[model samples]
Target: MTQTLLPATSTESSSRPVVAVTGADGFIGSHLTEELVHAGYRVRAMAIYTSQGSYGWLDHVAPEVMQHVEVQLGDVRDAGSVRALMRGAQTVYHLAALIAIPYSYVAPRSYVETNITGTLNVLEAARDLGTARVVHTSTSEVYGTARTVPIHESHPLQGQSPYSATKIGADKLAESYFLSFGLPVVTLRPFNTYGPRQSARAVIPTIISQVAAGQRVIRLGDLRPTRDFNFVADTARAFRAVGEAGPEVLGRTLNAGSGREITVGDTVKLIGQVMGADLRVEQEDIRLRPEGSEVMRLLADHSELQALTGWAPQLTLEEGLRRTATWFTDPANLARYRVGEYTI
Candidate 1:
């Protein structure tokens, strides 16, 4: 009953093992799906099912790329659904979760259900299906306010917020599967990934949308905090690299980022420069994370990832911002977001 779009070459045998993506409708997931398709892989894209038939960002992917993708609808939290979606796939990229930090504060249980339980479902399904590889997505937020200048995979994980707490739990679950069941899983902990098609809940999209709407003041929080951001394309490529890496990387967590840190305030100024507009920033109470929950700095030490796969981020912060600003300024793309509102 599932539909797979294949190119003419696949009409002969279609022997390429299918790769399933669990959050294929999301920002990073959608990009990764497209990347996988472009790389000659048959992709089974699992968009979260909704009655309205919306495929999230997948609806915006170019039709040519869609030819190699099979868009399946399912929820990751449901083990049966996950197993069904991954039945014929050789690899799975588990990226489905409730990722908003503020929303986690409001609905901690939802974060637990989606992030923790959802990961468990993927692990169980992968193990049961004898999948060749699994790439579990992790966040830089798990390393709360860096204890070291450039955080490494060895850094102690701190759960400063509910979202990070659940993600930590999910990461531990992935590790448990690798140890207990010998599931071939690689955990990819990516720092802030920003670019077009990112939802308004994230900082980069929110700031770009607000500025593109001609707002005089940009509402932001904790300008002193810094982050290491990777462009979406680079991040997607990193996922593929991790997925295809040799057995040496099994059960290991790799960090993917630009290895460059920039403050939130400076990012605003940089976006202003990209947009060719003078920007003023205002701190909003609603935008601020709880005092102890704030992660003041995150700089990735992706030496392990680089050594393993020869992967490095391709775009500088300014270049990525320029492209993001251009996309957000387009009337068609701009219409998708409510620029005046705080999404969280």
Candidate 2:
């Protein structure tokens, strides 16, 4: 299913430290893999092992870029598979996890297993292999509905959803390893990341695909809830920046975001504006999260990242949406998505 999903090879890396990404088949992971290759590192794009041998978004990238990296099929849950992939891999990027919030409610245990266990496996492998850098992926959901505006790393975490809870567990596990064993690791907490190749299960893709596909009534859950949207390209750069930040900032968590907030209602309007229409949002009852489970708002504090590494967001929400809308509007691309349906 990931065929034409992620780009799959490398051309310009030799003798540089290899950066292995566990979920290279995923949206953010695939983009980050590409950026790592462009940054002149030997990149090992490891997708979960499956019989079909699908490469996901890696396949969407031009073959010329594809020639610049190595693709490895493996699963994060399988420790041996993960360890073997970690060999000679100087840096490890662990983005392999089931992240759908709604699905987590139905199968909370799977979230705990995959998100928590998989992370433990990554830490263990990185520890033994002595991986020089480990940049763990953390989501803004871990902060739940923020109790304060522009939530920072010191902000308290609340597991408003099972998905958030599991991620919190995984993050805590990462922190423990860093503190106890001194693993050269940094955690990046990215706010709402939106871009091409994102699954429809996410709000941005769900809304953009539907609107771009000419849907008059764009279905959505809560419009009042706001999020700090970060373009995927910028978020990918954050991963590289975290790794290059080194030990002084080691064991620290940085927020990769635009530091700007937009309500879902306003975001829908923005998408409509990009699509050249003022589409109406219809509340899809089924699309709504459980009353108490939904995160009402999320605004990120990105100051630490800038002060620490001089890394800042480059794309505005409007620019990112225009690009994302353009991609989803392409017939060849739109056909890749089930735009007309409510994606659970």
Candidate 3:
């Protein structure tokens, strides 16, 4: 029997929602879950089921936050499990997916299963359960190498790699569900989101971990590529804003970004400045993505979201980097990652 959960709307006056987050164990998902909880929401977290019962990065968080959450072990790929988890919940943030582009090359089928089909399960559950709002997650990679500066939601989606292709498929499916079934859903396309709890698989964490551990030579690839990075808190706030926006912003995809772009090379130098370390960056051939697969540039057009919700990122790049460096420097936190070899 499924327990009855309150609608997110019913709890609005309390500055909270009885919300559920899929992929609450992963980086961005974990952070979003925490944000929702901190906002006074009754959060039920859906972590991927495993024999090890690992909560992923969520395990590293302060225990106080973890104590308040109701943990439901399930996999998004399983339609029945997803439906059960959505029981009585009003708002759903679907962030569970296989996201490594490099790994997708070896396991394209897993990408399709988790990214597309898994999203399908969440949408179906939300549609049937009458969830008040569903915020679907999308990545900047879906836009591919941008043909224009500051890419907007209107820009054509180019599937440059199998990973992006699957996400495009997932985003379109979410749109179709919203239009065809009247399922209240909003698509959130986030530029690179970085902060504490991010894994070494991501470039931000990879760079921070290597630099913090006293690496005399930092290994990197394709430093010329520019990326727009939004702090995880800002990204999480965007999700909350979409939920609070109600029906006015339904069935639309909005970008969450700082509206600023910087090259990877420049980011490294800035981090060095923040960390007060003088280190040489060396190009590693193994770290480079295939020519066609790399997204050479990404700058976000956040005007749409800003005009609608009146929210903007508050964290400066330096402050964000300093916080991230601090998290990685702590031996307790840094041990979560193996600094010797590359993750993805």
Candidate number with greatest TM-score: 1
> Mind sharing the TM-score for model 3?
0.94
TM-score for predicted model 1 compared with the true structure: 0.96
Error of 2 at 191 (Å): 0.4
As for lDDT, the candidate ahead, 1 or 2, is: 1
Q: What's model 2's TM-score?
A: 0.95
Instruction: Identify the leading candidate in terms of lDDT.
Output: 1
Off by over 4 Å in 3: 1-16
* Candidate 2 lDDT, 291-337, residue by residue in tens: 88889989989999988888999998999999999889889998988
Q: Please identify which of the two predictions, 2 or 3, would achieve the higher lDDT against the true structure.
A: 2
**Tens digits of per-residue lDDT for model 3, 1-344:** 11233334433524445788899888888888777766677677888887998877677655656655667888999998888778878889899999988899888999999999999999988877888888999999999999998899998899989999999999999999988988899998999999988878788888889887888578888899999988888888898888778577898999989888999989888888988988678888888899989999999998888888887888878888988899889998888788847787
lDDT (CA) for every model shown?
0.91, 0.86, 0.85
Superior by TM-score: candidate 1 or candidate 3: 1
**Total colliding residue pairs, candidate 3:** 0
